[model samples]
Target: MTTFLTGWGRTAPTPAVLTRPRSVEELCELIGAAPGRGVVARGLGRSYGDAAQNAGGLVLDCTGLDGWTFDEGSGLVTASGGVSLHELMTALVPRGWFVPVSPGTRHVTVGGAVAADVHGKNHHRDSSFGAHVRSLTLVTADGTARTLRPGDPLFQATVGGMGLTGVIAEATFGCVPIETSLMRVDVERTADLDETLATMAATDDRYRYTVAWIDLLAQGRRMGRSVLTRGDHAARTDEKEPPAFAPGALVRAPAWAPGGLLNGLSVRAFNEVWYRKAPRRRTIVQGIAPFFHPLDFVDGWNRMYGSRGFVQYQFVVPFGAEETLRGIVGALSAHGTVSFLTVLKRFGPGSGGLLSFPMPGWTLALDIPVGQRGLAGLLRGFDRRVAEAGGRVYLAKDSRLHADMMAAMYPELERWRQIREQADPAGLFRSDLARRLRL
Candidate 1:
């Protein structure tokens, strides 16, 4: 059957033949019979853009391969591509273990995480999901299953390859041991962008996880006002009860919303309240759900942007490019971009994946509702500026980036393409993103 699919941002819905492969054998069989447009794996569909949408092609829904094992003594977990972080955390937290890294949302599959090399607040300390991967099994176009480990060329190509290298069948990765599911958090509000950067750079090393919520709509003296939240897992003594990992969305957005629901005026109001509500400074203990995955508390929150959808732009600049970061923020504020969710974080280092997004620097992500005036031109300018600053945008969250900027942002693109070609000479793996960016 032809199924229509879109990324979490709800943009560019495309049609494809979606299939669920129950095992490695089934996956290989499906790949062998892929249509002319080729095949790409789809997990929980949390990627904000077209990285997983294979228009008019075969879309393998790998969730059927959900199975995992944990070697508690070694803190290693061997999980099939379909297993979600939510599932893993629910099971592991009670047993005193947790995924080495987690993005803003836990609804992503193990394969999806590896494919995007997803990073989290702890990136300043632990790098990305790819860094934790011990090994991964990839089913090539020729039905050859190869288990590649770190330091292998093929492994680097597959990690952060955006599901274009091949379908991630299964993987084994190291997990972190946790004494409890709660987090000990500290909150601080920064008066401006410079203060925010200084505070984080000076003290981020003290915490395992840190992030800042910036009010992109602020201007002049108040431009870049932000709330910084940093935390680490709480010890058993911090919580009276045993660790528990049950989490669920507190509410769901309406299926239908007005296109202009998140306009400049409304988002500005929301940003003001959000900024003011965060205490100037405070220390508290929070449940895992609120600390790391607060957005997960609302199901289908993407719909809040309304039917026209939204665009997520994420980019990272090297440590010395603070001026570039400030200029971009100032531009967005001056333009009244109406981005309700703007986040800033410090990344320690890249995971060494050929196309991994992070580098030892600062990263910022913004969620802007589509159809804003001059949105395309403004973002395109940002692309040029980012590339010029030796920074790269996150492919997993991108939608509007042009192909010409790919080489400028990622110098290793050619090497990654070569390895991808060698693994699947017939080019049996493809996606709409691959077509758009010519990856």
Candidate 2:
């Protein structure tokens, strides 16, 4: 009835039973009768860490629930839990609409996105994915489907509850109007940490989407030097012509890349070249595919991290905590961590979701190889600094945060846990993360 369990990064669990439920009823049935510590619904497994994984338990693969319908009058799209942003984008883009918020990768499922409360470059303007959600249908532990509205307290808890409350069966949210699936962007290069933050603060609001690619390998005065990319939805006049196709393309990567292929020397060289290549000022109109989901261009891109796999660490520190941000970046640089992708963004006000990850602050996300010695210790230290600054790490991207750190970061943890217990009194939905962090 079940197979093994693993995440997108292919980090296998200690052998568990995996169940692919084709419908909400099937999923509910499986969860209600699950034998182990309980069950956790898994999407496309796009989450880099164990948040979606339930070692030695039932892992419900929900990709089979991909169903969607659009309400033309309200511009609202209702999608099944398993529906992916990639699928939604392809269907909606040609119709002159876009998801209100999208993470860097489009492969994320609707359920996963809500659980993670994912944000994108536009976070400085819009906030997390949960902010746009109007309603959700959840299959509670009791096998009853309940529809939750934005104002409901349980709604906020479930938004970023990370599948702990119940299995998100369906979700309805508004879509943004767009002319073409394209973005009109401006690019700028900053010389140092202060310059980067200043530039972002100065111009972030001018663009609907904004992010900075930092040169993490740089040190001292050059520390945190970055290439800032800001963009707004492209207007009709800005586009020369409609794209020939909707750019619904997908690419896959080789099964594996050579070990140590992304070592310090290689990443440093890549970062240096990347820093130099950014122009001081430039304007470009790009397709939505390339602008929002650039990583999708290379299929199986995770292989680039090699056989050791990788973990994506994304954490946010409140505004005015520049020293905390600088300190974390400095530690990464000093450790020579070879992160292929390092992104920085300024988040706006957060949704009231108890487990929401973002707030009015600066958030940095990095992809680092898994086997780096002392990596866990380094992250623990960063966690302490973040907790001290009233910051929190994104649960969707975390695999190794300590229980005490989690409690300190999310002050409302107990509140969320109480609601979760009421919905799933027996704790029918659980994961390695939930067990490890005592959630």
Candidate 3:
């Protein structure tokens, strides 16, 4: 009845009474009678931190509620909250439709995606997952179900509410039309930070999807050197190259891999090899899987960080705050913080979820092995700088942010909190993250 649960990052593992709700009725019953620590929903457990974990409380695992419907004429998709994006794509792609927006991985549940309001490479063009959603069903603490639509205050809160408002039962969202699953990709390597920023700024509007793999270990003249990949769904209508189905992990890491395996030297070497491997300028046709979800190929790749787990630090600074972005990247290089994978992208505009992370700005994400000396202090310093620049960290990937910083990062926090309290006045919807950051 009790199990130890941790986020994808494997940090702050906690024990909870985990329940799998096979139906909306069952979920409502469980929530109405949740234990003292309160109730929260868990999807595939893909969140990097404690957003879905309810220590010493009840956790409703929503995977069993899988159900979906599609309308060919309008490209509208209605999927159960527990249904994975991979499952959705598996069905949609063959029908010549694709998710308008997707995070790096397809393993995320539709509910999880809505709750996080995830952004992808297309963010510079399409905004976030919440923007495409038409309506959603919410099962609140009081055992009632409500169908909320866009432009509703409660709907805005639930979009990125992290499940505090209640359990997301289902979502109806618009899908994009695609000729094929293949992408016509253009790759170019930038010489330095300024070049990388300028290039993306100038040309990003030309592509539907774009992202940069930045070399965080590089310093001096080579600082922020990166390989930029920009692409759009290929117009190739060849039936021979049908869209791909959901892909499985190409390989899985051992559970017992040693920790601290990504030290500075190893990371530097990896970055060096990765940078050199990219062509200076090239064009290629790639599958949507490889181009969007490369990390999905290596199952349990998180294990590579060793038993101690790793921290996924992602933050965004508004446009014109380029100075703040430069300072943070420079600081990381100086600290020799070993980040094996780093990404940089420009966001067009936010979906306006009260607590959504993306805005019209430059966002960067890094994977850092935890337990490094002064890692906490280093990240906190970065947080202060981001806050001062009118920026915020991504809640879905956060583990150590201070509660005091949330208001500054999100100007609409108090308004969102008011809606949340009105929905679940007794605070029946709760999680470790809620407690940690006082959300």
Candidate 4:
């Protein structure tokens, strides 16, 4: 059927021939005889941009392939590409097992996680999602199914290859062992950017997961005030048992909202109230959902940005590139970019997924409505600065990045291209992101 698809950000909606195949064999047949527009695979479509979108092409909706098997002894789970992390956790957590990593939301599918090489708050301690992946079952351009391990060049290519390597069929990954479903969390309100960074640097190792919610609208004396939260799984005790499963959506957004619902004035007010509500210093136990995936609680919350949609700009710079980070933050504040969901994280190391987005350094993500005035030119300028500073933008969250800056941001893009070409010389796997970035 012809369908209009967009990423979680709701930007760059495009029409495509969408089909769902029940098994790997059916998918292979579809790819083998795909139309001239080419074929690409899609999961839950959590990527904020066109990574999962293919314009006027065959987009394989892989969710129909969802299946899973778990081994309690080894804490390893083998699941189909279409199975979401939410599904895995829903079943595993109650059985005393948890996904090794959890991103901002659990709505992402296993295939999507491997393709994007997602990272979570625990990134400072654990590596990316690819690091825990044991193997992958892939259907490549030649319509052949192959099992790949970590050491293979194609394996690295497929991990963060953004689904360009092939359509993932199933994957095996190790899960973490958790005694309880609650997180012992510590929160601190920072006065400014310096304190926030300093505090994170000084005490980040004490916790397994950490992140800071920044107030970008604040300028001058308070340019990066933040609410820093860090936590680790609680040990079993005589205390009451925490909720074994994450909570589902509580309320859905209205059918429609005004385009200016998240303008500078509204965003500033929200940020002010959010920042003030957080305590100066507090330590408490919280549910897993509230601690890790708070946004999931509000159904279709992206619509709050309104019909114009939103742009999620995520970039990372090396540890020594503090000046560049400060400059970007200052520019955003100066422009009064309307972003209430701004986040800052410290990444530990790259997982060597040729096109993967994280490394040992600092990364910041912002959600700005598409209709913001001069937002394009402003972001383009930031792109140049990021490339010059030896930084890279996250492809999973990118939409407007130009082809010229891709190689600069990701030094291994050429290597990734070589591997992807070898895997699919006929260019069977394609997406709007690949076309836009000339990948």
Candidate 5:
């Protein structure tokens, strides 16, 4: 019965009971006999917030169920809920197959990815994790296991239902075929907001993966200055015998980095260097590990934000609403918020999953140090602006979104709720986030 708090940026929960079940039968027993009326499944605890925390209820840590089998003929991989993408990639990459979709980090589990319906830079071309899912095995509140497929309405609801629907025990999804574990990448720099948007709009479709590194400290004429990166799976001939597996090369950060070390001064300097260092026109061949999971190179890196931790603010704005994008970036620059990681991307079509986050729009994500005065209020204001424009926030990365804002942002909320209720009629499967957001 080991207990651990979630990732940075969330208030710690004092769960009445926490259990790590190594098998589905054990998981069922724990759920059936829990003292509390509510329960939730927690994966790698990488959600950056309380979405996976069950304060007074039962919290099931599913990491022990790491099991997976691949069907080489069909290129389909069925994995246990606890298998992390890092592990999956290590196994599949050498075989010339890649996860259909992956978020920025590789430390997340299959269950967490599906529960959040995670997306990546390729979203503008491939949609989300849910889009690749073919089937899943879920454990309902009554301790019953049900296998569901894409056509099942309950399947869509559970895909991004934030674990309130049930415990995702196993999942099967299609994998993308790759010629090599290397990427043929193109890099470009944009001098201002207009150029950045124009470049992304004009060229996003030319590549399978696209993202922008925004200079959050830039102001006035230089506002929204960015470095755009576009890439696709490299052809075998593009590189000489793909880079060999070198797990030892992954570096981990020190246990502690001084608080306020990443303040305005340091961030501005770093952003300047990054913007200037990026080449206006360049093509390079790089390995998949560095390209997809840059942050994962450093272990325990979250400790750098001091004990208070940090929150990742990720929101989307529709295609035509350039004003919303400009306004948000301008506001952040005005405040001089210390955000070390600021990313911008264009999303294409969206999946019909009731709570899925992405759509045909531009999305911005930032990692801001916590406890900044009025930070919560500022994000709330941003939520309003997003909702007003028919946009929504990603629930996977949210920690402080209000219930009303959530309802306003997601018009399909009621439909998801109905399906969830039908699956867990007694409202037994729950979490602090579900209660807080009234989901």
Candidate 6:
């Protein structure tokens, strides 16, 4: 059927022929009969940009291929491409197992996790999702399914290749064994950006997960003021058996909302309240969902940005490039950028995924509604600064990055491209992101 699709940001809607493949055989058949424009796999539409979109072409909705099995002895799971993290969590949490790495949302599919090589709050300790993958099955452009393991060039290329190498059919990955679904969390507020960075750097190793909510609107003495939270999974005790793993959505965003609803004035107020409401030095036990995927509590929350949609800008700079991070944060504050959600986290190291985003550095992500004044030029300026500082933006969340900057930001881009080209000589796997970035 001809369907219009957009990423989670809800921007740049485009039409395509969307179909669901029930199994690997059906997926191969669809790929064999693909149209001139090529094809790409999409799962849950959690990608904030066009990475999963194939404009005016065939889009294989892989959600139908959701078969999976687990081995309790090894804490390993072999799941098909379309199974979502939420589904795994719903089933595994009660069984005392947790996904090794989870992004901000649990709705992402396992295939999407491998394609993006996603990271989360525990990245300072555990690394990305691809790091836990023991092996993966990919159906390449020639319709041959290949089983790839770590250390292989093709494996490294495909892990974070953004579905460009091929369709991820299935994967075997290790999962973390948790004694309980609850997390023992510590909450604290940072006076400014310097303290935020210093505090996290000083004590990061003590906690398995850590992140800060930066108030981007704050300036002068308050510039980069933040609320920091750090935690590790709670250990089993006489706590009346672990609770069930059901996460409920408290509310849904309206189908329609007016633009300019998240302007500077409103965001500042919300940030102020949110920051003040946080406990100064409190340690509490929080549910797994609240600790890891709080945003999932609201269905279609992206609509809160209204018809203009939003742009999720995520980039990482090396450990020594604190100046670059400061400059960018200062610029955003000076512009009074209306960003309701701005997060900062520290990364330990990069997985071998050549195209994977995370590296030993500091990463920041912001959600800014589209149509913000000078948004394009401001971000373009950031792109230049990031490239010069030896930093790279996350491809999964990128929509407006210039094609020329890709190679400069990712030093191994050429290598990744070579492997991708070899795996899919016909370039059968294509997406709007690839076309726009000239990949």
Q: Clashes in each model (backbone N, CA, C under 3 Å)? A: 0, 5, 0, 0, 0, 0
Deviation (Å) of 158 in candidate 2: 0.7
lDDT of 6 at 239: 47
- Candidate 2: the clashing residue pairs are 3-18, 251-299, 252-299, 253-299, 253-300
Per-residue alpha-carbon lDDT of candidate 4 for residues 301-338, written as tens digits (9 for 90 to 100): 99998987999999999899988999999999999888
Instruction: Encode model 2's per-residue lDDT on 1-439: one tens digit a residue.
Output: 5566556666645456777888888877887788756888889878877888777778888899989999878999999999999888888877778899988889999999998888888888998899999999999988878999998978989988888998999999999988866789998899998999998988898889999999888988898899998998888888756532255437777787877888889989999999999898899877787788889788778888777788888899999998999889999988888889999999999888999898999999998887887988898889999999999998888777888887889999988988888888888888988887888
What C-alpha lDDT values do all the predictions have?
Answer: 0.94, 0.86, 0.93, 0.91, 0.86, 0.93
List per-candidate RMSD values in Å.
Answer: 0.7, 1.5, 1.0, 1.0, 1.5, 0.8
Q: Runs in model 6 with CA error above 4 Å? A: none
Q: What TM-score would each prediction reach against the true structure?
A: 0.99, 0.97, 0.99, 0.98, 0.97, 0.99
lDDT of 6 by residue, 320-385 (tens): 999999999999999989999999999998888999999999999999999999999999999999
The lDDT of model 3 is 0.93
Supply the global lDDT for candidate 4. Answer: 0.91
Output the lDDT of residue 204, model 4: 94
Q: How much is the lDDT of residue 105 in candidate 2? A: 86
lDDT of 2: 0.86
Order the candidates by lDDT, highest first — what do you get? 1, 6, 3, 4, 5, 2
For model 5, residues 1-439, the per-residue Cα lDDT tens digits are 5365564564554454678899999988887876555888988888988888877678888999899999999999999999999888888888878999989888899999999999998999999998999899999888988999998998989888888889999999999988787999999899987899999999999999999999988999998899999999998888657534444336676677777877888889999999999999899887887788787787877777876678899999889888988888899888777799999999988877889899889999999988777788888889999999889998888888889898888898999989988888888888777887988
Model 1 scores what on Cα lDDT? Answer: 0.94
RMSD (Cα, Å) of model 1 = 0.7
Q: What is the lDDT of residue 385 in candidate 6?
A: 94
lDDT of 3 by residue, 1-439 (tens): 8999999999989999998999999998998899889999999989999999999999999999999999999999999999999998888897889998989999999999999999999998999999999999999989998999999999999988888899999999999999887889999999889999999999999999999999998999999999999999898653357666667899988877887788988888988898899999999988889999999999988889988899999999999999999999999988888888899999988897999999999999999998888899999999999999999999999988999999999999999999999998999999999999998
Judge candidate 6 at residue 249 and give its lDDT. 93
Question: What's the residue-level lDDT of 216 in candidate 3?
Answer: 92
Q: Clashes in model 5: which pairs?
A: none
